[model samples]
Target: LAKTTQPISMDSYEGQEVNITCSHNNIATNDYITWYQQFPSQGPRFIIQGYKTKVTNEVASLFIPADRKSSTLSLPRVSLSDTAVYYCLVGEVGDMRFGAGTRLTVKP
Candidate 1:
């Protein structure tokens, strides 16, 4: 996966919105940006993905700018249960690396 970086934590109250951003300037053309959500002691779950522009699913929305160097994951009306680690990975699913992820904190 293309290398990426994001904030270590974000504070949010219950019923509020949260947005996490990631940066991967070295991303390749064939690489796709994918975001994952992981609660403590659990594996990361696929949230959203996009090559460019915006892609929205039932869980979250992914927005990738035209440059493709950065992406954002937007969660609407978050709750305390939503507090979890969010990861941004770039590349195919099979091509992944083990790295430290950003730990998100949601407040109630």
Candidate 2:
């Protein structure tokens, strides 16, 4: 499994967009960039993922650079209820490990 490094925190106001980028220069060939969003006491929820290019769903958009060394998760129109921790992990589902994540503060 490849290790990922990203921000420890980010701040934004309600109705604003937030984009978080992660760097994994040592990302493995079989590894995938996955983003998770965690509310205070709850477990993280899958936000988006991609090995390359872009992927967008109901919640957010994932943008992976061509080199595969970095990726970004874009949240459209965040709200105070969106305050949470965001994590970027690189690896297979079962092979991944959780670490202290970036705490995101969405102000009203």
Tens-place lDDT per residue, model 1, 18-85, is 88899999999989888888888988888888999999999899889999999999999987888888
Q: Model 2, residue 22: displacement in angstroms?
A: 0.6
lDDT of 2 by residue, 2-78 (tens): 77788889999999999988888888988888899899788889888888999999999999988999999999999
Q: Model 2: runs farther than 4 Å from truth?
A: none
Using alpha carbons, what is the TM-score of model 2? 0.93
Model 1 / residue 27 / CA error / Å: 0.6
Which residue runs does candidate 1 get wrong by more than 4 Å?
none
TM-score of 1: 0.91
The candidate that wins on TM-score is 2
Error of 2 at 88 (Å): 0.6
Q: Distance (Å) between predicted and true CA of 37, model 1?
A: 1.0
